[model samples]
Target: MSYGILSKLKLAWTELDNDQKEQLGPYLTFTDYREIWAMGIFLLGATALLPLLIVTIIHYQLIQTSVNSEFILRTERLTSNTRRVVTFFLDERLDALRFTVNEIPYNDLTASDRLSEILSNLKLGFGGLTDLSVIDHKGTQLAYAGPFKLKGKDYSRQPWFIANQKKDSYVSPIFKGYRNVPHIIIAVKSVRSDGTWFILRATLEIKKLMQTLSSYKTGRYADLFLIDRSGVLQTPSEFYGDIYQKLPLETPKYSSRTQAVMTTDAQERHIIMGYAFISAKTTDTPFVLIVVKQKDGMMGVWRRMQANIKWFVGFCILTVIIVITIACTNIVNRLYHADKAKAETMALMEQSCQLAAIGQLSAGVAHEINNPLALISQTAGYIKDLFVIKEQYRNDEELIENIDSIMEAVDRCGRITSQLLGFSRKFDIKTQNVNLKETIFDVLVFHQKEAQYRNLNLSVDVPEDIPDIETDQGKLQQILMNLVNNAFQAIDDGCSLDIHATREGSDFVNIVISDNGCGMPEENLDKIFEPFFTTKARGEGTGLGLPITYGLVKKLNGSISVKSKENEGTTFIVTLPVRIQKEKDGNENSIGG
Candidate 1:
């Protein structure tokens, strides 16, 4: 039954022309098992990576936010300290001027000698008084002392002279006055007992003010300077431009207390700046005190920490990928083996059912055909007997030949039916000594036509001295025939099939059937013997040939194994016991018996 189906499939595969083979090439190729493994690994890695990536990004953002907050707080503290020191210095100088004006009378301050003495006293005491001048209510200089030889110089048209006329005392912003140097003025308007008004003016040394401002300990990257309401730099900044240079930053609105803000300078450097407007009751002019620090310098420690965090995250990701790859590979490998075993077990069960059904069907088919076949044989024989009695007709060659042909055809039909019945019959532990050479030759005869049609070369190599084996002849024949037929199906024209048999030790015979044909991939090699698992296209096979052959070999107490490679061909080896052992009354029966 298996032979008939296998023969048909062999014929179909061998009959394919070159063009058909080309068209079917892709379909004939093995499935890409790597694609499955790759997909499994990718899914596993992505599952592990997505959450880690999101968490890492969130952590980085939180760290940056915290660092920025701390940076702003530190900058504000520095700016506040600088503003306090500068305000105190200006207020101290203003107090000195007011004290001198009230102590000396207007008559005494207007005398040149007396005024010079007072100037000397102020210069010694305060150390920043550059020059001194006395002016009356008419805006005329009444007395002058120190530097720039203008004892009678008039301050009537000057802004400071007019400003001091209205206010009792005033402190001017830093400016280049008649002396052509950056200096501030401290002026006091005084009234005598008779209600006569006089003004005392002094030019405050700018260098001393710069020293006082710089006395505050800002960090290395920070700069402290003074800017007037016009946004001009009043003091020389070590980092910013010189005195009187226009500051690049916008002047903030006047605030009694220090105000800190983040900004960028002209060079595009990030900076934190704080400003405060210095105001006093005696002074109408206000000056802005500014402290600036580069943001990068201030946040240097945080930047280092951020870099280290990045490296840590990178190492963690790398480690995770490697771990995921190893873990997923092991898991998928186990699953593949388990699934393959399950599939083979299922296929084996299905094959048993199919074989049982075929056995039943074969019996019914042989019974139904045998009756008509017998009637045809009997009728042909009766006609030959009648012709023999009629001598003249018997001598007629055509008549005799026709009857003989009918009998021969009927005999052929009977042989076919007998073989079918033999295949369907269940044997009960029957064993016989079978010649290895003769058995292989008989199986070859069935495939001779197929081999010739496909232009295949077939050969057998059995040593003449090899001993016969005790096995079921029918089962042995079926096993060899299935393997040869499978080889025929695997190959195209011009391929070869070689069958060889040899003795193994004293107990076993090894039969090898090898073909130079289109081989299978390693992944499917284990499944080739499984039932309903043919690599052939749909409708071309019933997938029962190898499984039935496997069962028959096992019934004879033999094992079969196959080796194959893509485009290289395949070989199947069957190992059977040289002497079959029979059981009788629960004891092993001797071979001689």
Candidate 2:
């Protein structure tokens, strides 16, 4: 690829500037980056928090609706349940009244004292009952209970008496008696089971109805009462303290729907109401079963939910602050390092150009020296040959040794020239799929003599499954040779060379060269990959080895990481891909170890 295109591709794929990488140690891991990204999205979207918070709210409403429905249903059932129990109790009391009157037979119970005994028996039979009375069809009150003399009072004009004239049996809605004790009268109009009209009536105090409706505790705000078809209160209400008094009804027409929900205008309260249409199975009068549940009583659940939302919002704010602080810190640190690295890199590039010029000069000197050295070696060889022919002089050991010394100097000069040529030339990288393990082995073979001279135990452990990696074979060999030479140079005679090859995940092969050599401190580690940055003394070392290795690794689209502890050991991990995967089929492919 052209330099311009390559630069663009690098910029697209890389997250930070080259300068930053040299400055900051390294970016955070992939996992940490992902977490920060998710938190950012959440914080950004927090503006519409409440509408999307439906998951926390809908359940409460659903449960409240279910309970309200159930309470209304249960209350209706209670109405029927209460009526059945009360009816039976009233029936027994009425039967006793029948017995008392029937036993008198129009002659034996003419006395007022005897009549009072009958009334007392009726009162004792029923609880919470006040006065009792018997009313004839002529509307005359015949016999009665309590201190009021109700014997000759006519009630034919009353609705209860008028309603009985058309029906065989009936119960009146609540009304005021002559003495004004709140009461209702249940009358049995006997007609010989053939629809004839002879009626009997008994009055019950309104307090009894209150006692029945009061059985429910409908929260603190709820109140229960019975309303007649005329919108008159049949039982005493907590709000009004009235019986048989008209309430301001929302509707004038009687309804049979049996249930309703409405807001009372007088109190401005939302109420859930349940009503039952009266059946002949209970009473002749069309009474209603009414149950009330106040909406104000349900504020507890709402208040608690409000408190929970407060805590949730607070937690979100705290989380956002933490994430933003972390993000800003990381970004600032990266920028600082990048700027530092850029400055250092510009300086280093200048140094490299100067060094390259010096290398060119050295190569020219080596070439000039090599030609003279070759001539000297040839002359020395000819002298040795001449001496071999002169037997007498050949026996002179001093002359033979001197000639050998001259040849040895020529040989040493030739080796030095070769080393200079190798270091100075710029060879084009020949890329191919080279087995990394095999390349390492080649380097080891070339350095076998030096390793032996140092009496070093060299070991190799390459993974059997390692893939053949794409790289310049010669460049890799040179890099490995430099590293191995450095390793040998670092160690004493008894120390060993440890080499291992393994796959690093799916996309890379890792070759680790570790040694228990005299390691450097952290101060030197930072400059270890810089050109000419050496830890060795003036005559012993050139600092180009690691920098060359680093450059070669980068050229192969790979990386090198090092870890070391002073006096303990040092490891150089070289990572390379198994194949040079081109971007194809609209996807990036990574192939490796």
Candidate 3:
């Protein structure tokens, strides 16, 4: 059952008009219209985006390179200025300590009263001095003043003490010592003539050192701080960390001159940093001064430019896709129409040629054969008449039957010749009120004998409610006869044929003829109405019956369609208008040979 349905659908698809067929042609194969459309879009997209991608990459690299160069220059400058300020501060304090040690006697330095006076004088001159202390060669604090009491405190185990002993002077990183405030110590070691050593140490305020570094005036997002060789923060940074905290940045290789680098921070912010090692002339301990700035902030103008370029490129790609789609669709549609028109023109020309050749052949046959058929019919009638008059011959039943059979054959041939003549002859439009049921009956009657001989079941159902339609009687009869004859020829023994007729609308009637037979395949069904196209073997059919029927129906202003499957059956439907309107000239009959 499913196979039957599929065959029907296949037949219907093939029966579609030329325009519809052309529209659906591309879909009937592996390479469909949608695939073609997709391929076109892909090509256009690639073409449009290739240049955009290249330009975007080049622009991005250029922006990054230019920004990096600018960031390095700016950060390096800030680093240099901050280093200078920090170096100056440390030098001043060390120089002050050296002077104090050289000018004061060793015994006086050890005296608490004299050390207090010296501390007062140092604080008055340098506001950052937090405290002052005097230590002997044994790393013991003999005298101390300001914020901490140390009449006799041992400092031998301290890193600063060991460093100060080895070096003439040393500057330590800021730390919370006994005073519990962040401060750095600057210690100067002095030797007497007898090689007796003493040290003068002063704690400088961390806030004052930071203020000097910040005064350099960097960018808005820039930060400056000092880190030890181990990457530990010595000074407080607004964005990095507190003093004595570890810095996130890696420690740079020791360098006296400033060096800059670009990197991303933990927050994924792009940054440029410059660092310089601040080396004191009198000490070995070195501090790194770092200046950091945000890369995006430094290249804000370039970022805006990149964004604009991206938007422009996106717009171009979209525009190209739309334009290419429209253009491709237009081109394909135009080609489809042109090809359809060409096919229709070719079909019409071929039909014209077929009709011309058939007409000439029909005329010749009718002229040459009609006379002999008439003569044979007349002679056979005369033979029957003579046999009836002669008693002896009339009594011979076998001879009488033979003469009657000859007369019948002669009449059949005459009818066939007349039909051929009528088919070839063209006539002006003629209309008469037609009894569709009676006409169908007449055509069916000719095929009834053959149907019975083959043991075929034939049925006809014309509704009583159907009204008579006005059409060309001869053409209508021919149409019905051809269709009925074809139906009878299609079936074998025990098959069924059905004829149905009804009024379709106020202006038209429909007749359907169906048969259970060895039906045609889909390919043959498509060409069933074309001139001289047939499934019958050579010599069995002229292949002109259906074409002539088709022409006659067209002359009466009607349409015909057929559906068939390979093994199921065949059905032909004829739709005719109730009436064909006469032309303005109103000639009842005209002749064309």
Pairs that collide in candidate 1 are none
Error of 3 at 378 (Å): 9.7
Across 1-593, the per-residue lDDT of candidate 3 in tens digits comes to: 76753443231222446765664444443224445556776887788778878988897888878877977987888888778777888888898899988888888888888888898898888888877888888988888877767668888888889878888999987767776888888899999899888889888888888888888756688888888899899888888898888998777898768989988887889888888999776775558888888887777788788789889878888888766766655554454455546656666555645665666677788879999888988988998999899887988999989998898777766665665676578676667888888988887788778877888898899989878888888778888888878877788889998999877778888899999898899888767876557778754565668877777776777889899987788999999888776552242222114
Model 2 regions more than 4 Å off: 1-52, 63-114, 127-146, 149-153, 192-196, 215-222, 248-266, 277-282, 298-302, 313-593
Q: Which candidate is the best by lDDT?
A: 3
Cα lDDT tens digits for candidate 2, 188-242: 6554334423444667776665776687545565566777776777776676447
Looking at model 2, the pairs that clash are: 19-338, 20-338, 182-206
Comparing 2 with 3 on TM-score, the higher-scoring candidate is 3
Candidate 2 vs candidate 3: the lDDT winner is 3
The C-alpha lDDT values of all candidates are: 0.76, 0.64, 0.78
Question: Please, what are the lDDT tens digits per residue for candidate 1 over residues 1-593?
Answer: 66753443231233445754454434443233356556766887788777887988898899877776676677667667766666666667667767878877777887888989988988888788888988888888888888778777777898988877778788887868876887888888778777888888888888887887888647787888888888889887767888889888888887777777888998999888877787765564567888887888877788898889889878887887766666655655555445545555555545555656665676677789999999999999999889988977979889989999999887877765664565455655568899999999999988888888988999899987678999889889989988988888898899999999888888998999999899989989867766457778854555657766776776677889999988989999999998876642132111101
Question: Candidates 1 and 3: which is better by lDDT?
Answer: 3
Cα RMSDs, all models: 10.7, 16.4, 10.7
Better of 1 and 3 by TM-score: 1
> Native-vs-model 2 lDDT?
0.64
Candidate 2 lowest-lDDT run of ten: 584-593
Provide TM-scores for the models: 0.70, 0.43, 0.60
On the 0 to 100 scale, the lDDT of residue 573 in model 3 is: 91
Off by over 4 Å in 3: 1-19, 22-31, 99-121, 142-147, 216-220, 248-257, 262-273, 294-303, 346-593
